[model samples]
Target: MHGFCMLNCFLSRPDEVTFTAQFDRPGNIGRVHIGKAEIEGYKSKVGSVITSRDFITNSKGGPTWRLKFEICTFPLKGKVRFAFSDSTADARDFDDAIITQQETVRATPEGHENMPENLNNLAIVLLQRFKRTGNLSDIDAAISAFKQAIHLTDEDGLFMPLYLNNLGNAFLARYDRTGDTNDIMASISAYRESKCFDHTSNPFYIQTAIFCYSRPATDYDGYPDDRLVAAQYWVGLSQQHDPSQVLAAYSTAISLVSQVASLSQTIQARYRSLLKVSRLSTSAATVALGLERIDLALEWLERGRGLVWNQLNDLRTPIQVMKPSGADYPPANITEELERVSKALDRAGASRELWLAPSAGTSFTDVRALPGFEGFLKPLIHADMIDHLPASGHVVIINVHEDRCDALALRRGVHELCRISLPDFSYTKAEGLRESLKLYLHASGARTRGDWNATRGMRREGGSGGVVKNILRDLWILVVKPILNPGLCGESKSLTLPEFAISSYIPTFQTLVDRVKKPRKVEPENAGIFMISQPGTPNQSPIPKPERNAAATVNRVINIMENYTCVHFACHANQNTSDALKSGFALYDGQLDLSSIIQKQLVGAELAFLSACQTSTGDESLAEEAVHLAAGMLAAGYRSVVATMWSIQDQYGPKVAEGFYASLIDSESEGLNADGASRALHYAIQNLRKSLGDSESSLVSWVPYVHFGV
Candidate 1:
């Protein structure tokens, strides 16, 4: 008796045929024939017949016969007939037949119209095999096939990039095996050539390029700079795709930025490194916001913005002394080691070895394991930020992207987050406003002393001042008004202020008189005023300068900060665009920079009124980072800060200060309300606006005043 089955299959490339057969009798034989051509090397037609005894026993204790045949030795095309036969079968089973393509059969009939595509496909198959088997011959064949395809295809054809990209893959795969620098360079050259294709004309080609580039960009073991370059390439290529794809590319690039500017480097080095990817976070958040993923946008902002400042906060976290009851504290020695590493990390030039220390590795993990510390030293998620919101007021974070502008407001006691869209505001408008304000400042010389004397002539000329007025009005209508909508921030009257007395300590400014008088004079030890002023100027009062050195000036200010409840500055502030840490307030002889103040870490500081030029103006390149003097004050332990977004008019400074102080000090309670700093600034700016025509024209004088923190 005999049993047989036949299947006709088409051959597109070189392939293999495999099947398993089962026989019950010892003398039963199985044979495979392709179009009457029997396979050799197993049981040759001229030799002995293979019986069931020669087959291996399967799991079911039945004899099993497995056969494999390579199609490369046969014809390249056409239907091939496959037949299976079992001899002397009581019952024979033939199962699990599979045809696996091993490689691409070279384009047949020599001058085919689809020859280039066939060669390209052939190269891809070879390249894939090379990757799997690490075979040099297969990669070489792939590279050769790819070059042939490229030579045959038109230069402007869509398939050209595909061929070049495959060639690059072939070269890159070869480089992995041989470690040859030439091969790697060749791979890069191929990829560069592929990118020369016009993305607009063929978006599919661009997407293919993105896929090819993303592989190396996200490779975990790749060099940071190399990965960054690939990631940037991926970002550029992804722009042709949809916004969601573009956002994914930006997400990848932003993540790679941390590797480039890691904490193992010195703070200065990290900042310098980050300058390469300046505004990257804002761009990513903008993309995320465009997709209406407000939570994702916030998360990206929190991850990428203020990175250095956040690192400092983490390093200086007082985890060593934190021994909460019922919590599993780390051993005393572990805590001590963590303290040592934290201090070392905070130093100016922390070495990489400090980061690699064993204690540094395990310290944060152990600390985070303790109760109420799970989020310690980690980037705060949206939920974590909401949980830490102040008890009474809303925290509105505004993000300005080119696609859209939005404000995310987290109100106290509200579990749901509110998103307010500002349709009129855009990144382009903001940039334009910034440029116009800058031009007005430069044309009118409205900096340093905050004097508006130079601006009077320009205002009369009606060029710069009118432009600034319109800019401010636009800011109000487009950005501020939308955010201040009652639905988001609630009514102004509903805001509550934390009770505190500024009469405890006050830093007297140059223009201030007895406008902020103490309700009742206290003992000298309990109440005091410290003044810092530059000499050789008008209204330079009896305030004495202890030392003229910049360091001495910083030390004096820091000492006052340690003792004072509130400090006010009516001096010139210079914002360092290159190094934000160097941005500071100009004092008697020199400048007291932000870095100096932050290093001191003052305690019991209540409020800081920075009534100076550009106190809140951050570096444009580091827009997401709060690297201005106002932010420095907050980081240095001030509960509230009143700062100027631009240069304030010297004449109106005193009036604004008077209004701010008056609004903060309650006559009935005889105390200063620190939490009302935001409200007080609004009150002062409104007063200034009223005095200066109470219209768009007044915006120039009043708009610069801004309040930061509660």
Candidate 2:
């Protein structure tokens, strides 16, 4: 039986070396010989044999191996030669030859200094060997070799970052064994300093720096403050580069933040850590604001908040959107044969994570090169975007920070951005309120599974947590009422009521009950019923045929979304903590997830009323970041969104729905547009308060409703 053969050569001396010969052939006894070199124990039955420095092949099978080996001293001019019988053997022999050449040159100080490239190459191989065998000596050798190479290279040369990155990696490996913090610190410093060099043109070097900073020894189990500082540093370094580098940096920083959350022993601690890291959004916002670009600022805020999931879902966009355009096309198109190849290169260069597939192009150069893609993915400028809002409503942007909160109010007719001070509002206070709300709702039996019909019109405020009521009052007085201003809400004919569009997806309650009872789909009488009405023409509204699953809901919406001016979804919402972007509506058959809604990028989606539980709530760790369905819809191109901050009672769902649509339809009939959503919701909540006849219960029913987008 024919089997394969392999040869390995070890260069122990500048003038002489040794070779090891091995074969895959079992029990085949063969003596190996080279021109002037002969294997010791040449007659052994074993497949491997060692040979002296001078090597040549002599076997019964003519020209058995094609590998050509030549050992030269001094100027290293001549190449020793013998051809391998197979191409595979040829490639192996060629690689071995280079290794031998590098080892010989490294034998002398003069030779090492004269060829820095050779030294760098040898260092990479040694580091790889260290990885394979976990040999400390190999890593040490790699460090010494890379240091020499770095010293010999010019400061401005392209190879400098490569050399420095490799040296840093070698030190990190040694630090792991010796527990020497100094070694790790030195590695981080080297990596940070190397970024100053013009290595932006090289993808691998950029990735190397990111890897070094992200994997610093100080990051592992460090104090919360220390880890945060390290994460900040990573994000800072990431911002100094192009869009691709920024994405990579934030991706790693998000992981670090998640790790911080996981390391916490309590939910409160985790929330606090998340609050601190919320600086991620503020920092990105600061940069975007400096550019005088509100659209980019919004994108930065959204992307910075939901870093991990955003990056994962970012890549899932269309390849046409990912195609290289501007400056990248002339060079990139020639270099990368296919758009897929360009995408592959993009994934290779910018991704910090290996677990998920790359969906978005991170290369800033590539991003800017695409037509109309400047300022990072066709930003929706403040002017153009606000046009989609209702004339009767004001757009309030609440910026939450550590020191304070600022609410910026903009209306369709207003030219100036009005700043409102929220001196009493704070993140800590908001969190406390949230906790109180959760406790109150749980104690009140609001979220419990039951026939909500049986409990209709009943006052269920047993746990009457007064804190939530006070918080709502403060929100109305401080956040909402102040933003509405004195003259904005006047009965002005110029500011007509906003148009209305409504779509409700509700799996039959009986089906929901039966499924929960048996953990499977229930073929009940009315399984997948959707209720939709033509805005301003609700009298002629029709209830569509019952669809079977989530896909049907998605497809139905896709068919009707363009027909309606503003859209609303009244369904069950689930906020997926494990993967926030996958969080979505629980419909028949499946989930109408964030990914689907976002990917749609609806063109004329003016307003979205997500009358679902926790529509505005996201993972606490990403509190400052907009990782909720509302933000997802905004990013998906909706101008304004009405969502819930927390779950509301099932009974109130109908009241809120009926009140919102009636107001919206009336306003639109008079030409106000849909901007009345916020005001309508406010009035609806007020009406609910009147009906409840108590502050505490009303807060439970209405406080969860919040506005997003414009």
Candidate 3:
């Protein structure tokens, strides 16, 4: 109720983009320092200028690694500086940033003129700083502020991506700091942001996405869901924009080819290619055999498989290996199926040959095992390969909750059969499949605990203090996910998309209604007042309206069950007992006593549309009392109760109900729910929107119409 509405993004770009890089051979120059780590070169058969690390680092130190930038033949007209043009903060903050290097520091540039490509280097320089010191504040500030810099410099310029790449680094650093789930979400959310309608490749955007989504932490809320969602995003974007876009070219690098192959499989199958299914099974086999806790090993192994099957599906053999001094071992199992699964990938008219990365500092190679490796693909490894991915598989250290549990074994045997039928999948170690996925059998929601309070003269005779929001959220999530990301859904499990899931489209379409708003408040004196047991509240003032406050207009309240046609109720009614449920309704006053007037109302109504409480039996006897669940509501004139077994939020409940009503009413208007058409004029569901925006009454009085039916 107190949350801010997240502004829905409403741009209409046709889901893809084109990219063009600045250099003919864009790549990592690598550790090109000679003997004393000092490499010097001069112009030979080229129009280019030289920039030494000493000039950039301002070291004047022992040695420097230098780069030779080929000058623009037609005209080397302008300068490209790495330094950002705007920073409100002092230089000390930049100096204070953490940095790491194997040995010997690069000399720093003394002034702005002496530096080059600072916009592209800011992120890396800060990254180097963070890697060395582990302080997050500096990096966090940079991330928050860098967006301004990105907008300022990268506007259709020739070397914009040079700046965009550094900006991407800032975001990545921020993600690394918070592990704040939504932060990760926001970080990757803007990866493909458009600058101009031109052919420009933002590899940094894709690269950052791979990092934020792949090797995430456990405590981060909804990690797997976020990561999986992130994958679909980039994969779809890549396919839509440029399917063959690899981190680097692979035509000449066999290992790089394997890495790109892994990349291909992930996107082609829509993240389904199971590169290491056998290996995952074998590792889980170890766990089943009561072997050592292989969680960490499994995590590495699963990720390795995903990298092979989901991310890189081109090259076979190996990309890069981990070895200390002299080590001997069998090649990783997951890497074996890269070339095979990649066959299923859809050709987005892109190739997997152009991939690149730095040497990432590998001491030696084990190519002695390969002779038939004559593939035309190439590969490269970067120094910072989004560490912790470990070249290991995911399942090894996969969290329990992300995986489904044995709940599928209860009642419906689909999951039980699914495991055996799909032996390739693994078992889940989690408990409940999110309370949201959990349905309350007969009730729309579950009660918090065993006890419930009853208020006199109130519609909700039995209401509890149970919390059901999380469960409902889970339900909405499960129902909406498949529709939002069908490819991911198809790969993970066999759940079909629920197009009816309201929340899924609500963001994209603001018209996703929740509850049918109530009618305007008229003088209560103008409405018909009722009583029960022949003797209710002495003067018959109607216990302060069922909502909040003393002066409710009560103009457009729900009619008696016999009052309107069922078509008018819409989703406001619980799906139980014909959707005319009046469950979970209670006194906004929060008291716990049976309201006699409410009891009599239920006694007369044919359909017990209780979106209110959760007591099955009555005070006296289940069948004898007018408030009993099964018999009383049925005996009273009502056919059923769309009630809650637990208490739900008054905040979004009405909105959800409003949406349900809209859907229902929309369907009924077209003859879907024939019985819903019977509702009379004013109190009909069609008037909900009009009723909610009634500017006459204070907001509180109109806030308590959460229902339990239909």
Candidate 4:
């Protein structure tokens, strides 16, 4: 009784000792009195102890005395012992001395006797069974299991929301198969309720809410306005979080719409949904604008219409920096990096991550941070472009919205920006005008004088080519003319169209003529050769014949392009919608795509004449985006661009080129400047019109050739 025992226990006990004793007799159990208790190593005295009733163990075959104690030492270890009756007669070991901690256990829900024990497993099995057997009963069983799991889960637990979400999804499936409104409504309610318990910042749940609310709310046919209220509610929920999430959600939604619109393929596939989402963006901006939130309006516009510009900006950066110069070549590493960036941007429409810079508001910082990217192109904001507008010329932006349209106009020297209301210009009218332009061009190209019936079919009063004229006239009157008029500044102005004029500022440019042809000797495959024998001439190479075809030929066009002011491409042009950056002119030794053109800063380039086929045909999927070659050139810094909408007659390319350059060189008296190009193009087309004698074929010859930019 006087001896002490050392024991190891799981409990973290204080060093102060509290001893409990138990004594057992056949008739009764009573507390045992301990003389004294002391922890062997600790100085703290024992506290008072409470004893339990006598417990009998079968191993000992006798009643036993059990004792427990605590000491004030921090290690939570102390000595304790149990004394058993008849211990000396037949010694037996007591295994109950050791106290072990028990872990908390979660209850797993089971299916029926023939099913899985785990609720998740059972739910999955039922879902699969329903899919395989086409039985609604299995889905109902799964839904029930999910609900059971949800109920058993703590209300604030992480798994609870997941269970609820699963239950809602199952309900949605049932609704889809059965066309039951109740099931869908229940599904929406379940999802909404589940959001209350979602404490984590995962955006997937937010995306789920958007999809859930959108189906019955905004996207569904004949859905009630109350559904829209729900959709707005969910959107509000998402907007409550970080703004980055909201931007990503809206960006993803727009991309999805773009994919759908692109898939429609037909020019006439003006999917109302695409228009609807775009109009929603307008509405969002309108609200922000109403609150005088111009910054927010600009953000909204950048998210939508500014999309293509941002993409092009990113695409242009590496190309401009990595472009080879005369006697200089891009190292293998630079070439590889350029190719990688190009591939990433090519698939940007499908990847939202690529669309955004690694850091917000900056474009291509990730790419620019790579080795050998010190001089990479920098990103630009809307204000930068606005500030770059010509002092004399007006920059007009026609914003087509759902309920109304407005024209935003700015000039370089003018401090005040003007907004003009265009009651006649609507989204529907814009689409109609686009369709009409396409239709007239397509139909007019399809027939000659021989096909009178086709001609007659297109000759309705406001139909055929009249639509094109009317659209141009409207654009001029409603959008353009108002911006040009001095009446906004209180200057008296006539309603008649002003004669197209320009300042007498003479801009000079280097004339390049690069057309690849077989040279006298093939170049060495390993020399990394990039040299020009003369300006505007095919570069001479000294590679061996068979190996020349095997070696990587460097493009000289990119090297020489930035050195000049007015560049003209008379080579074969190809458009790659799959990779718009790759859509470019086939130059000597290599191809110069729009990627290169846009990347290369052209502050020196006054005019660009892309005398190639279909130089201005943008990807139809990205029609709202200005992804065309002409636009790329303009974006590259060309104040004026002459591009073709479709393939022109091979013989006509040179004639138009000659006419264009001759007008620029010969018309000094006309005060030929940047604006003079547009007038020159108009007169050039007029000359072509005269040459072709005003026939439908003449329109075909001249119509494809058009002017863009200032």
Candidate 5:
């Protein structure tokens, strides 16, 4: 019924903090003092009595709370270092140069080749030493070591990923060393590349380590409250992963143990008794102290799971059938502990969504600073009206929804679009849409859980559509309008409809526009004409496939333009937006589509960077999202497009679109074809990207900027 209690001795609060001893350890170093800083290790083996952490060098996890605490407080003082055994570079490798074998597919690598997993473990030990001795040189050395690891450039795929992952650890160490955004992003990218290489399709396991490694430190740079939040986040995140491996990592990397100074039997016994008494009298003995060592806590909890499983009234037999694998994972003492670990891991594994949900240590600054932060949000688009933009001086349109909503699964979101609409008290981004959706769902006989979390998994049958609507409503009101231009929100019927870009792809006018009349050696003017998406380096020795396409297209189009500068981009479009739909105007061999069919691949553009919808949409709105298409011509040197807000129907696209190009050309000078077209097209797309709040912006199909050049 109750949990096994341990004497938790940690710096919970300054001045009033209490310290107690659990027992004496191997090679007792000295007499116990209440407050002097100490260095020790925690050991699972009995009678070893923890001494130095290096006892287990091959394994790089457990705890270093005391050391981390010191680093967090005076971050400028600590540093980290690393040494790699292998490194490489290979062009055939679609994987970043990182590799690691993991326990599951969801947490494993997705590509054939891998980049090194970034890390810097040795530097961590030195950092702890710096904390104790205040050695500036140590910090500098750690920084240098990590940077060297990051810039490791050998074009051959010959290095080991373990070392690469450790290089990532350097970023973790630096972030702890300094609460700088660059370090966090660098760390995130290193890990992401790791996923691209390894065979596992999942990216969660690496994310877990990154999260813990970057956890805010207590009294970090002199912020005690921040330290508390950091610790809480760590515990929450550590517990969120599966028990088999995640727990071990939490134990190895996060917890720090101090030696009890091996004592005689009488002294050791007395120490234990004293610690127990202190637990009752001091606040430091509360759960939070032990909470930091969640791995150990989880170990204890697993024991408790036995009884807890039986206690569950609606438990299934299959779940109970899952037994501990051999002696390596024996049953634990408490049933509830098992329940806790199991629940946390299940939730973590089940929810693949990278959320905007409140994490204990999360902030906008940290999130935005993460590498590819902007790219991450591209996947969540819902409705886009940028292409067929309707113009209203000011408007507020609301669709109450055909049915009521489930009050239990979601919350209302509200935000003022920066330049789009006037500030209305009741109108909000996600909140208003959520409200209408809930009402509609309720009318339609939807159910609810006590409290709600908007994960896609926890929705009713008709829930997703309504949810998407609200999300679109929110996306328009909050993110899109503010991003495109908030001024539009002031005069228009502020309501925006939904469009799922999942149906297609679209190309740019450049695909339709004429190319140079002839082809020749590289010229400076051609720079803006096409950009190559070489991996590793911006300008590599080999031109990419996209660039090759650009060359071929420019050659053909230029010949046509020389005779008659009039043409239309003939291609397919889909229902997806941004990268999903593959945007930017491009031209690919028509036979390429046939190849996709033969190969059984998702046939499309080389870089569907920013797409709104596919040309494949149904001829009419009767099927709603039923008919959608994709469009784009493939070209060499180009990767994708950074496009408009969201989905846009086909009919309205060319109309509002025409206005964009006209405005663009008006801004350019005569005789400057390259400059004029580039600038003009960008202007047109950006203009169309804005929602004027007219009937045009609400077509509810695909939308995105098309990129097609050299």
Candidate 6:
């Protein structure tokens, strides 16, 4: 064929033959000829039909000359020859060739061996053409062809899965064009069926599965559970030697995590959901870094980490304080609607009504449409997070993945991030360290207050001590040192100002300045600690107990907490691995769990000093979330928190507490500045390190002490 042409023929006897030919060039005449003789590289006399009429324009705005012809003396049960000629000299379109082949094969008798394969090829070409032409008919025809091919394919055949995958893609394309839910459902069913076959031996099959799973996984409007399952499937398929697919899988999984652990769910429900996809952000960042996309790595880390904490923070943000450009105050109706919705959500969460919060949260859409509220309750972007960084010091976030480890530092006065690579540290090493520490604590009789034995001194000895020493040393050398090195971080600067030199002024001005700068001793009444009695002890309550119930005790504690600027808990803490919301500090009457602490929402709370065991240690299953007592305090409105990572020595806890408080409350300061809480904890830990020999052996006491927030 000189120009694009497709032919189909059916023959019953030697004397009768019929076929059709299609031409694509305008005003191009074509002829179809057939011969009954069996000829190979030889000429034969044949009957011919000519098409000399004007061309008809097809739906795609191209001239088409379709003609049917009958030939005499076409032999049956023998070789038959056909030829086509056109007036134009243009090359045939590849798509037209595929169509021609498909038509020829389909015209054969029923039960043709290669019918399914040819149909699949034809459908794929049609889908491609539809993509280029934006023609609904082409896609509809492609879907029909794919379904027919799949129906004809044998269930156990090698190409069945391939045909089903093609069908799924066609449905997805149709869904994008038509917005039909049935098409999406059909697509998911097709993809799921495609995965039934064993694809382990062939990388191509596995990649095809990955490609199929990615459609539903990244669809934002799809069902959340289905998307999660698809993303999990993508993750499983992408694990074998495809770094790009791994990154893409994790990126989708991480995005879906927020939907799974949605704010509409209760805190406990959110944590339970988050446990399923822990460490996704870390793994994603590792893959992105491997591909040299540092920006995406950081974005993924920020978006996925501390999801629950970020949600609570967003909820607590004051709506009235958000001033849109040219607006003096937010509209009263919007504020009222938000308050109503917030109360309903709170009630639903409190009652554990799973179905109510989603309805309540829907009202927020109207509020979000208001000026200055477009991003209300949405996940924060990296730029917004950078704007919230402190004016001094760097917030260092370290991520540990199986493939690699690194620290991303968001420093003051710099928009770009500082990335510090930690080649020696790894996920396996970190897990080993955690396991070793757990075993050491269990062996040393320090898991809880009841487990500790005073007679067995808390000193490092032999192999267990060696393990603890190695753990701390490895953390410093492999993780901390690399990020804190001078070449990477430069020199650290003091955030506070120093006292002025008296000699820089004249005698008269010096005396006036001294009076102005004189430090006034803070009265005890202005700032004080609110401490509760140790659990199981018969000490009097700081405030009167209304009743002996858990609710009464919590209310009493809340009342006392409201009057104070800071609170200190120096008791045992229990970490419930199965349900982190139940993890809490042991109180005199009952346990003060994280659920209670967050629900109270204490106001004017500045600092929380949790000198209890394992206050900052989160559940290993939910590592990415800050589901611990310290984080609970922060979510409950505390600006700063001082927590221990593990169990502390019975005597050392008091020493660290005393040193921390001594530095925190300056003799001349007017109030307890929570801004200095981090510095205070650092000073306390350094003193403890020096007092206990300042070596790897003494790390158990000092390394556990940690500070969160400014």
lDDT of each: 0.58, 0.50, 0.27, 0.47, 0.29, 0.60
**In model 6, what are the clashing residue pairs, if there are any?**
none
**Candidate 6 residue-wise lDDT, 197-302, digit = tens:** 7447777776777888999898765556568889988887787656568877887887888777775556665776676677777777887777777777877876
**Candidate of highest lDDT:** 6
- Write model 4 residue lDDT over 1-710, tens digit each, in one string: 21211111101232332333432231111111111111111112112111212122221142222111111110011111212111212111111111100000022113322111235444644554465455897788778877766666667764667778877888898898899999999999999988878665688876676667556444433122234345455456556753434443443343343333331122112222233344545555554454454544544554555244444444444554455532244455545555555545434233332222212223345445656654354323345445555546555555576666776555676656566667766778777777777776666543221123322333444334455556656766665555565554243333323244321210110000000010112122211112222112144212111212222223556766666556666555667654545677654566666656655554455667776667777765555444567766655566667888775654455567668767876664323234367767766776776787534445556767767754
| Sliding window of 10 residues with minimal summed lDDT for model 5 | 76-85
**Which residue ranges in model 4 land beyond 4 Å of their true spot?**
1-285, 288-387, 439-466, 473-567, 570-574, 586-592, 596-606, 619-624, 635-639, 646-655, 667-676, 689-706
Shift in Å, residue 707, candidate 2: 4.3
Task: List where candidate 6 sits over 4 angstroms from the true fold.
Answer: 1-154, 157-196, 200-211, 235-249, 318-329, 450-453, 463-465, 486-527, 538-553, 667-670, 695-697
Query: What order do you get sorting by TM-score, best first?
Result: 6, 1, 4, 2, 5, 3
Q: Where in model 3 is the C-alpha error above 4 Å?
A: 1-94, 98-116, 119-156, 161-194, 197-238, 241-432, 435-710
TM-score of each: 0.60, 0.45, 0.21, 0.48, 0.23, 0.62
Least accurate stretch of 10 residues (summed lDDT) in model 4? 509-518
lDDT of 2 by residue, 409-471 (tens): 556666554566677777676767678766666666555422233554424445354756565
Q: What would the per-residue lDDT of candidate 5 be over residues 26-129, giving only the tens digit for each residue?
A: 11111111011111111111112122222321132334533332222111111100111111122211011111111111231233122122223334444444
Residues 151-191, model 3: lDDT tens digits: 55536655555455555666666677667776566555444
Maximum-TM-score candidate:
6
Give stretches of model 1 more than 4 Å off.
1-220, 223-225, 232-250, 320-328, 347-362, 454-458, 461-465, 482-530, 535-552, 667-673, 695-698
Candidate 3's C-alpha lDDT? Answer: 0.27
Clashing pairs in 1: none
lDDT of 5: 0.29
Could you tally the backbone clashes for each prediction?
0, 31, 142, 15, 172, 0
Question: Which scores greater on TM-score, model 1 or model 2?
Answer: 1
